[model samples]
Target: MSDVVKPAVPPPATPARALLPLVLPALVIGLGSSLLLAAVSEAAELFKDVLWETLPDAIGIGRWSVGWIMAVLTATGIAVGLVVWKAPGHAGPDPATTGLVDAPLSPRVVPGLLLATGLALAGGVSLGPENPITAANIALAYWLGRRLVPGSSGQVWAALGAAGTVGALFGTPVAAALILTESLAAAPRPQNPAERTPSLWDQLFAPLVAAGAGGVTSKLLGVPSFGLSLPAFDGPRWPDLLAALLVAPVAAVLGLAAVYAFPYVHRAFRMLPHPVLALTLGGVVLGLLGALGGHLTLFKGLDEIGELAADPKGHSAGALVMMTVVKLAAVLVACGSGFRGGRIFPSVFAGAAFGLAVHALVPAVEPSVAVTCGVLGLLLAVTRQGWLSLFTAAVIAPGIGLLPLLCLALLPAWLLVTGRPQMQLDESGAALR
Candidate 1:
């Protein structure tokens, strides 16, 4: 399944003249999208500091105190609820119903989505900024591109925008490329013989340009690398493969459990009278879990997971398990209740913690091997994208030596998750395809 086979008939070469028009537009979309992502992220960080730091100091309460954590989360839920209830476009559909790249939303929906996203991120809602940011950028790009370049297609701008946002989010173009490849491969080929089907590279060329620009802009802004700091593995061994097989499947199972529960959770939340009530109650549950699991289990899990990777041994097996379970539940609640964020970041964090816990218990599995396999499985189950799952795992635990092992280990997890319900939902609130 991983191998690439060439088509029987080659595609007609794309003219440089035809590509020139896209070059300028792709560059603009990439740069503008990155700036939008960065600005919103910084704004959220500012609010986060005030909510978790300055306010706590002013009130003379522990930042991690149960009451304080609950208060802030509940308040955030109310604020976001108001936005969803009153803001234009209702924040652009239930977040649980959306994927990383969907149809571009109305531009009117962007502000509310960004506001809700900012609140969710600031309040340690255990979600990341990917989905909403992508949606906002796509909307903005499509809206402006149609005006600025009258001949450009909406699909063109949407693709460029999605690619750019993905590149910025991951701090690399390869992730965008891999993700877009999966999407492009799913597209139906033209049936007419006279109308040549484009090769994968041709399909990806414009998006890649946009992704590169976004990635370079993000790097220039000094975002930290996505790779985690794990103890290096010496080499792949039979035992390590066995360890990966053991760890990856278990992590994938945990992720699938959440995927299975997603709709049920969303249904439960919808039973409430209002979005405000549902989200506020959801926030309370998250706060209780946070207090139980500690702050390590809060937020989107990127920085927290990095802290764990930096010193995997510092946490006990029990603590790691608590963190993983709490994070899984938090993601379900945060997203199910209509919080604007993505699951990938939280899932990555959960998988890493689970991997470290396995190491703590077994003591034989190498940290690098365990971490990568764990992440690979969880991402596979959560995102249901093969190349994406593999790429993310490799990025989190950077070691060329582990690539072959990861690829092989992915087979079992992929088999387990294939045909299962995805994390997203359809219009009727059932599991989306």
Candidate 2:
């Protein structure tokens, strides 16, 4: 018989039972990592109460004046500078240069990073705990994974770490899944289904499991969802479209301005031989911004954003625009310096301020919708992650009605930012184009 060799069929992707080893560990790490991250935030708040409120009240500095703001931020800079320069592991890598996913730094660096983050957060730096917390969680998770599940691949660890962090940060599995799906969708695939290459579902299964676990744990722990008290979107109308068209592009332009300035500021700070000097100088500048923008602009911006939204009409359009500028400037200073924190929260805050300004100017526009669109445009340019920007806008806007408006608004925003300078530092600390 003239025989033809047959290609063997790959066993139906590994059975669910085979995923048990990964699922269990991922669940554990995800939950534990989320708790750890939450704990850090909680601790920062506690210390903030002491440093900001308790201390101020104790000494009878009931209200913070510009001089006090300057003193505190400058002091923060000195402390952060010392940590970066003399601390072991150099307070980990510069956050501006890192991506959402990267190799974990040496375990030794963890303590310094945490210390620096706590110092910044409590001292009113315009940053969030996101980057530092994610890095810490990933390093911790990976370390445990290797010892506990030696058979697991690095891909699994990366996926689980990312999912866990996203879940913890956003308090939902959907954010993590959507973000990962976008990245994984275009990855190279093996033609042979029977090969060891994992199927997409199989690859996603554990991360989703981890994400779900982290999200559930956070909910159980009573973490709050992000939201603003505002009116719902009316059915998409011509005016709505027109407003979004005008708002998003303007937001994108503002974002580009920040992106352009990011590297130069970073370079200017880096030129200082001593980390202390760089961070100290950054703090002094931030103090001035806070002084000019008012106490609302001093911190990472979540609370300030809530305040802004609580009474959108209370502040005048000029005031909102000024807040936007000051906040953006604060973000540039915090990120460019050696502060151990994130830019996302401040970026969103700045975007919201810009949106509020637009709404004030164009009374035809809906306030909440403008805020959502502004956030979407800013994030689209800042993170270069379209889905995340859209998702976050929907999440923050408080209803499904705004989704259509946000989606339409995103298109024009994307065009403006697609090839522009990104808000990231290249290897040599220059803007990535």
Candidate 3:
């Protein structure tokens, strides 16, 4: 034995048998994640109808009136603020600083997060269910998985939960697979020469299973798919490629502007003496924007995106542009003021509107191409998630014909967003530079 003792020979790569035992647990985690997500969403919808329709109608007020919009949103802000300030675990963390996925939160924090998320969703906050749902699922999975699989690490449960929730959210295992694959690929590898490195699929096996289970369960539960039933792309022409090139990078630039503004906006809200005041003020501002942007600009963008797609020409270009701007502003305020939610859905909504606006101004561009490319660019800039951005764009437009053009469209848009500040803030209370 020399002074530098060689490392002991490591075992061979993880065998398939070793992973077989995990299948059941992964399935359980996936189903649980989807169930939790569905429960929250359904509850939110019930509350949303009560707030936006039933109560308003009962009171004999126009549900879409500016006064009603402002009042409900303001009241919502106060309620969410109180929850964040006093509820156990304070709803986990500031929405402005968090990403779609993070380390698992404490079990004690889950209830408060659910309450906050439900309120935000019902109140028409311009954020999505992705973030809080993912966090809560991870926490629950970790807590329960420890009892289920005593030897498993927290990372295992976290990955399973993330995969499950993402699948449920997008209504497809592909999205979860892409996201987890990207994440696993970036993880550091073992350095020992004797250690046999596991293949990518080896690492992905359990999570993919979890994702699949979650996706199927969500479908069985009748969750709406993300695919908008748009007119098919009539194959890509040179002009269509040109339209994509022109549209994508422009949308990326718009999203980048919002990214750059995010930290400063969060800081402004932080200056308020209390969470309640900050959130209430944010609600007031959102109400004003909603009053201007109209009903199309309210809520997370899933239904609104479909509504916009259903009748692309119904709104004037000016109206579409206004909807896009006001939605972006509302997302900024809702997130920065400690509201618990994600930005993806709202950005998707805004992207659809912006794309339609471009089409309204220039009818020569194909609606399918314009809308998909618009979604691609904005998601690229805002999420900084290449696979997810591409996947979402393709899902919304649904055609193999558009795939090649989307790949090309993503190139310039990616370059524009690469190395820029992400929408998330770091520990120093500044956007990641």
Candidate 4:
């Protein structure tokens, strides 16, 4: 959540009107950072296009092959490992150990980390673009802010930059605002009673401005939403509700299996003693999983999830189950071995696959409704953000009729997931590299 960084110079009890000036700076930083990262992301996709599509065509491989997939991922591991070894930032903080709101990193390390992340993304690594890009933007904001406003705390820029990135990535400031609320509200009161900390709204004001700007910028640039178009569900059937109540808990428990496995994998990867060896080995393992699960399990899985949603019944139940399992395993290996990315996208993919498989077995259940509930359970267990879990599920399967059923489903799922270890690392990172 939020770290309690006592501002060195106590912030004045400035009136609300006086705070309006900060919005301009926040907006500029937010838009600028998002634009910069957007370019980076586009380049990454192009690189991946060359590797996965263009290169394949040039080589005249009539179709995708397992051998080619294995070779690419393995080479990717070595390339990223080398960058980590020689790069200025050492790939920034170990992503496996870092939380969503990590301390700002030094500016010099941003480029190397950006390069490494691009390579990972292009290589079909089973990770999303959240972690490393946010880190890069934070550093960018801080470096620029120091020149523009030297007295301000670095935390301010870090928060705004992160909010901006989240907004841009999700195409909405709501996700960024909601996700950061816990951190903002949870900030511990300073030790000095005389010092008045800013109100939560005051703290959120700047971030919200940045998030709004970022969201607008992304929309203008035509970034798409993660919403899935499912079969028309006019009303929640009684059978669907019953099915959700039963299936949600199962999904929660299934996701927890990976949470339990994470730290162990983190520990094992750390034992390798070198980034080169650790990541290379991880990449090779991911290649094998890709071979097993096929192309659907590769990358961050956003596009692939859409593919499955577009044709839910195209694959058999067993195949869907294998997609979930192999993708989960790939997420663990990629994260544990130091490939920087967020857990949200991959977890959503895994959740959808699990739901599709369950729906295949229980024909009485509606596919979209079941998928939403399954996303609810999986996100609850994985991210432990209750509001976000519900919000994400409903948004993905946006039908007013589905909300009540999803809310009921969350109750049983919450119980199953509550008090369990989350898919996050402790601040100490004793078990992490």
On a 0 to 100 scale, what is the lDDT of residue 45 in model 2? 83
- lDDT per residue, candidate 1, 205-319, as tens digits? 8888898889899889865446798988778988998998878888899999989999999999998989889888888888898898899888888789889999979999998
Write the candidate numbers in order of decreasing TM-score. Answer: 1, 3, 2, 4
Who is ahead in TM-score, 3 or 4? 3
Model 3: lDDT to the true structure: 0.90
- Would you list the clashing residue pairs of candidate 1? none
Clashes of 1: 0
Per-residue accuracy of model 4 over 1-433 as CA lDDT, tens digit each: 9999976865556686867978998899779867976887789889999899888789987324888898889999999999899999797877787665577889888888889889998898998887788888888888788778888877888888888988887788888888888786667877987877876677888999998898889889876557786787888777888988977788898889988898889889988989999999999999999999999999888888899888888889899999989999999999989887778888888998999999888767888977888788888888887877887888788587888988899999998887888887765544321
Q: Give one clash count per candidate, in the order shown.
A: 0, 1, 0, 0
Better of 1 and 2 by lDDT: 1
Off by over 4 Å in 2: 1-12, 186-197
lDDT of 2 at 115: 90
* TM-score, model 2 to reference: 0.93
Off by over 4 Å in 4: 1-14, 190-198, 427-433
Record all residue pairs in model 4 with backbone atoms less than 3 Å apart, i.e. clashing. Answer: none
TM-score of 1: 0.97
lDDT against the true structure, each candidate? 0.89, 0.84, 0.90, 0.84
TM-score of each: 0.97, 0.93, 0.96, 0.92
What tens-digit string does per-residue lDDT give for candidate 2 at 1-433? 9999999655358786888878787898789868977787788889888877777777777457777788889999999999998889988898778766667777789899999999999899998887887888788777767777777676677678878888878899898888888878767776775555666677778888888888888888875446777776656778888888778888988988888888988888889888899999999999999889988887878788898988889889999999998998888889888798988888889999899888899877999778988999988888888888898888888678878888889999999999888888878886776
